[model samples]
Target: MIVITAPTGNIGRHLLPLLLESAPAHGEELRVVVRDPARLPDAVRARVEVVTGSHGDAGVVDRAFEGADAVFWLVPPDATLAPDDAYLGFTRPAAKALAVHGVGHVVAVSALGRGTPVADRAGLVTASLAMDDLLAGTGAAYRALASPSFFENLLEEADSIRENGVFTDVVDGDRRAPLVAVADLAAVAAGLLLDRSWTGTDSVPVLGPQDLSPHDLARIMTEQFGRPVHYARQPLDELYTTLVGHGLHEAFVQGIVDMKRAKDEGLDAGATRTPDTATPTTFAQWCARTLKPAVLS
Candidate 1:
């Protein structure tokens, strides 16, 4: 059996459907650890064994990891806590459970810049890398999907794009870096979960087809929406202030600030885009399929 956590999230939503269609053919029984079973599609709820609770809960993970061969581990972001508490603390229980249950393979969602100098100081990314280490200590064959920003992140700015024909980021408009689609990340996770021949702890960089700058994204959005969309660079200080003003934990907000700073310093630029690392979806395609509809709607 393969256990999938956060099966209703952006990456998990896509991953669940792919596994649902394919796992049966491989003689794999599927299980999901979700907070609300009702959030799952009716058809999906009927197909998989559901362990209802927060995957971060020790009891929940103990129950879910039992009899599991592989696990797709995606930690949901918690802005109310500090970076280490949100990432590493959340995974500690599951790490123990994985060893106890002897779950051999694990595919986790993580950020880029593992070996880069910025990684150690990148706040949330640093916390996430530490979580990966904790899981690796369990002796599971772990693969952390080292990804850059997602094209879907732009969906959060749909209203701004629609109203002002602009999107915002903390990076310079000309700074190019790899960006991925959540679907691509999901597909990569599904592949690892299905084929467990690989062993040892390592990371797979899910870099998109090419590196794109904010200006390139603006150009693509303009083309896709037939509007004069533009890129607006937000000051890092302003971003931190705005997030903290929204009542997020001060340390958590600082983590966001630090992560943005690291990315600006080329934290995500360490990976080379080989065929193994490069995923198929382009920014333009993502805008057409995902962004355009959100902005237009």
Candidate 2:
């Protein structure tokens, strides 16, 4: 049996079908822990066993992990919570459940920067790494899908890009960093969850075809949309102020500010792309295929 959490999320939504399609050949039964079973597509609900409750709840995860062999773990972000509570606190229950259930393997969505200089101070990245440590301590063969900034993150600004031909971030406009598509990340996770050949704990960096800065993204956006798109670097203080104004906790807001600072300092700059690390999608390809459609819609 294979278990999945956050099945309605960006990566989970894409991953469900792939796992279901491959289940026959792999001889795996799929289960998911969802806050709302109704959010699951009718097809998915019909195929997989569902434990209806927040995965962070100990009772929910304990029930979901029963007789499960492999699990896909993802902590849904909550900006109103502290960094520790959002990452480690939420993961502790699942960690305990994994050990208790003796699950064979675990695949988790994490961030890159484990060995970087700024990793200790990288806020969310730091917390994610710590979460991995907690899971690794459980003795389940764990693979942390270490990804950089996701291409899907741009969708959050699709409307602004469509209206003003601009997108904003706190990172330096010219600092190139790895950007990956969530679909590629999900595909990789599905492949890992199905096969039990691998053992031990490791971080698998899922990088895009190439590294590109915000400025480069803007150039690609301009070409793709046939309009002059631009990149705007928001001041860190201003970004923090805005996040706070939106009712985010100060600790959570600071964590984001620190993460952006780390990125600007080249936190995700160390990973060298290889056949294994490099995924197939490129910024230009994603922009044309995904972002354009999102903007148009």
Candidate 3:
């Protein structure tokens, strides 16, 4: 059986078809770990056995990872102060469960630039590095797929674009950071599950499409949408207050601002390892293909 965590998330949702097609024959099982089985979509619920419980619970993970050959691991996103600290509290238990269960292979979803000091302020990278290290010690064939910041980040601005004719982020409207599609990340994770050649702890970077700045994103939006798209750049505190007003914590806002600072300092910019094999859909293409239509309606 192949078990996956966060199966209702962006990449997990997109990964379903490929996984179903690739499962081993003679009733190779595909199971998902979810806090509540009833919340899963009908299609995913019908296709796989839903392992009910939080990934954080050892008791839940013991059952979730039981009989599982490979596992796709991910922690829930946190928008709080010292996210990395919070993650250790969350991921440590799950890591123990996987170790106890003797899961054969693990494909963890991590972010790029995990270990650098600059990553300390960036929530996902800091937390994921800890996760990678802990999981590595488990002796399972572990692969920490470190993907670039996702194109899905654009979704957070969907409401602003639809209502105010603009989009906003901490990014300096013109600086480029490698941004990838979740589908690409999922494909790489699935490939690792199928091909268990690598051993110990390893990382696969998924930098999809090329680097793009908010200005470039705006231009793409203008072109694809056939409307004058604009950028809204806010001061760090302003952004923090705005997000806090939306129910996120100030610490979470600070982490986001710190990420933009990291971007400004060239933290996210990196040398590409290989020409990407995954569908390298540009932001414009993604808009034309997915986002534009959804928002227009």
Candidate ranking (lDDT, best to worst) = 1, 2, 3
As for candidate 3, its clashing pairs are none
Give one digit per residue, the lDDT tens place, for model 1 in 1-297.
Answer: 999999999999999999999999999999999999999989999999999999999999999999999999999999999999999989999999999999999999998999998999898899999988998899999999999999999998999999999999999899999999999999999999999999999999999999999999999888889889999999999999999999999999999899999999999999999999999999998889888999999
TM-score, prediction 3: 0.91
- lDDT of model 1 at residue 26? 96
Ranking of models by TM-score:
1, 2, 3
What's the TM-score of each model vs. the native?
Answer: 0.99, 0.98, 0.91
| Residue-level lDDT for 113 in candidate 3 | 78
| Tens-digit lDDT track of model 3 for 28-134 | 68999888788677876888988788887778888888878889888877665456555677777777877788888999887677555577766546666777888
State the displacement of the C-alpha of residue 155, model 1, in Å, after optimal TM-score superposition.
0.8
Question: In terms of TM-score, how similar is model 1 to the real structure?
Answer: 0.99
Write candidate 2's Cα lDDT for 148-246 as tens digits: 999999999999998888899999899899999999999999999998899999999999899999999999999999889999999999999999999
Clashing pairs in 1: none
RMSD of each candidate? 0.6, 0.8, 2.2
Q: Rate the local accuracy (lDDT) of all candidates.
A: 0.95, 0.93, 0.76
Model 2 accuracy (lDDT, Cα): 0.93
